[model samples]
Target: MKTPNMITKSLLLSAALATSAVLCANAQIKLNSKTVGAATKAVKAVTLSNEDVIEYTKEYIQWMDEHNPVAPADDEFAIRLKNLTANLQNYDGLNLNYKVYLVKDVNAFACADGSVRVCAGLMQAMSDNEVLGVIGHEIGHVKNTDSRDAFKSALMTSALKDGVSSQGGTAAALSDSQLGELGEQVANMSFSRKQESIADDYGYKFLKDNNINPWYMSMAFQRLLDLSGGASEGGFTKKLMSSHPDTQKRVDEMAKKATKDGFEKPTS
Candidate 1:
């Protein structure tokens, strides 16, 4: 039995298909079937409202707090992290919030609610500019709405499988435990290669927009490659290499981009 919302969605999809057919027949420039299909799918996908997204974000933050309490805003590392992310807030009218985890992992992530989480180890390992590039990459995820997609996808999957709620239900339908599981799923998600590449490009634009040396993007990747000992695969190296583009390839591209943009390499 299709729910009322499901029926409505089905009708919308049918309409989209009909419209695509008409457009294809009358179009001056031949429309690619793949492009039309992608556009139709984008319209058909079910997504949560902004209010529900925020609710999920708050729940996920609470769960993270329980499992991995954030470093205090006044902590030394936290202060530096804040300083690093300060410039990012005013970009494109986005007032992003920053937090530092006391964890030792060399990773960072962002949330749909404009929340940015940086690991203390990342702060210690990279220079401020290098750290900024990483944060820029994370910000790219939020700016690109990848974070929102991840949250919506995770919540919808859980709701359907776990009977948490209907597609249109408010966030209140999810229990704390279910929200916790959703958060865990979100944290572990590996974004698609295309998405990763887009984020990297966004990060580049971010650094250039702020008048920061964009070469740090290459430097950051090179640093990781060196840390990984340029291994073909294994351990952290595997994780880094498996992230969409090859590590060395990305490093070379960033270097080429810097030169093309008339940004000179730093004197060492």
Candidate 2:
């Protein structure tokens, strides 16, 4: 009953509506695709395998070694660390490698891959026995699988943040920027009080097993306590205080354990 012009107008309106519907549907499909992709990534992040962790950690450590000034083989710090850890090359079931970073930051860390890094500042601050105690503590973290867990957590966070690709069941190589972010996360990582205690116990036993005086454990904590008192808010000393918590109590506990085991504190 309508005129030709009216029919033509109706047809145009229908076409416009149909086009709009198609566009909206396409937009919705794109949004849903994105949501699915993000969800898949999240799942991958959560279900990261141990192999993935080691792979990512290898990349991160390589990045760190490239960025930091590692002590040369002939350097005093390197020589000292090599001498100290010579016998520790094959501790327990883990094959360990030691390196000293020629940095002034008083820090030491061990990775899941049995890579132990000691900072020069820490070496200068403590006696040989005390340094061994600190190294023992780091090794304890590795022995307890805490280092692995920490690296795993860091990898998960980095994967979620950086959208690390995992195509064909293989994790993608991390970009340098992503490696930097991951290194930062690791540098600021903190172990729980329980984990600290466990590592402390392991360090204690590690010293005794190596025929070293366990009194050095208390001495190491005492040195850290002394350093914490003079350290700035952002210094590694203060960070260690915050992460380890109960400094005096831990020192006292180590001292008590050492005394109970009949190990006399050496007077230097």
Candidate 3:
């Protein structure tokens, strides 16, 4: 009973039990912890809350609909956009509520909480896959919390109130058009080219991860590049105004990454 073999076995069993207990402890840590909760939630908390973004965007769009000629598409567009975004985003642990405005501008943006707003003009300009690429780029912005950072920077640099509503900061008591100026000011916000690269990296990661054709994003950017020299068609102003890199070069880089990452096209 006192043999060395018996003692060795006992020690081995004890060590194995200890290791198992340690692992279980590690694995059982709360999924709701700061690092492990919903990925989108982290984006919101660190950058901007989705709820606030949605509320503000909704109110802003509603006002725009009333004051301007633009209106959001019928529910059908929302349904289609949401479906398309969900399919692509499922791979990244993110989702979105896509909205299309009947504006003539070629711009699209995503707010925190996956609120994606696209101009009808932008929608009409690209193929479905190309549009997915465009949306993926904006999703990169949302994931990177650019909207929050950009909005904050805009607010800091301006003397204007937060919005039309009496929400944040001192009131300038400006009229609706003046408030619109503030909105444009906020929207015109841009980050360094570094930020644009980061957004591109995120976009690439998303495309590669999701098994969507990674080249689509690149191709979409190429389209932007091709359109860059023209009269802008006015509707293309927003896309042109974005502080992104030369679309053609970005497209080439994305293609290279897609190849390096071994991205396989989704069958179907």
Candidate 4:
């Protein structure tokens, strides 16, 4: 009894529903494989001293400031982030610095030297508390020395790129140019699943320490899950989950932590 146009709409709706069902199924089973990331080639471990880490991190921060276009210090997002992170600065001899980049990518990161960079797109996508949760996770990385491992991984990878080998765990000092190249690599380095889990624990603890709603951790992950289209099927599957494992598991863990801390579940 339906007209031709009405029948066409019905078919489209049915097709969409079918696609959603398939995506849901795929999401459940997609992360079962142990190896998830695209980069698989192993790099031998290289050791860098704490002095080396500090110097290299400083240079890397300088290079980023010089090369990348950052949001103006007075810009709304920059100011907002500065204010939000104010309380986290100057604690335990760890002086944290915060900056906002005008990049379109929805990302935020922290370095071993306590430099935090937040992208404008990420701020636009996440709420204030969610942003705080992400910042806390990054701070956790620095606190747990995960950033040190990431830097070492990057240096090792760069050594391969430069055709250099280490001797007895004491490698040649990277040249300024090589260090710059290594810096770039370190900037993009992804932490292991264990490191991320530790960072998540730190984030939850940070929320509690600052009298913030611990549920923000769950809210942040849920926001990411939603932004990734509620399934591990597209860009989210390829990028975010590729580096970080088990998005849904992370969300569930955060929810459990929040509930354990006597916080209500985040609805959104």
**1-268 in candidate 2: lDDT tens per residue?**
0111111100000000000000111111111122337666767767877777666656545545555678999999999989998899988787777777776767677767667777788899999889989778777777777777776676566544435545567766665445445554555566667867887898899899899999999898788778767342333454344555467888899999999999999894
Candidate number achieving the greatest TM-score relative to the actual structure: 2
Query: Which candidate number has the best lDDT?
Result: 2
lDDT of 2 at 190: 63
**Residue-level lDDT tens digits of model 1 in 135-208:** 77767767777766666665555532333332435434444445444544453345566766787788888888
- Compute the lDDT of residue 139 as modeled in candidate 1: 72
Q: What is the lDDT of candidate 2?
A: 0.64
lDDT, model 1, position 261: 92
Q: What TM-score does structure 3 among the candidates reach? A: 0.62
Error of 2 at 87 (Å): 0.4
**How much is 102 displaced in model 1, in angstroms?**
0.9
Model 4 per-residue lDDT tens digits across residues 41-116: 1222234465555554564455455445577878999889988987878644668777776765566667677777
For model 3, the stretches where C-alpha displacement exceeds 4 angstroms are 1-82, 86-95, 161-178, 230-245, 263-268
Q: By TM-score, rank the candidates, best first.
A: 2, 1, 4, 3
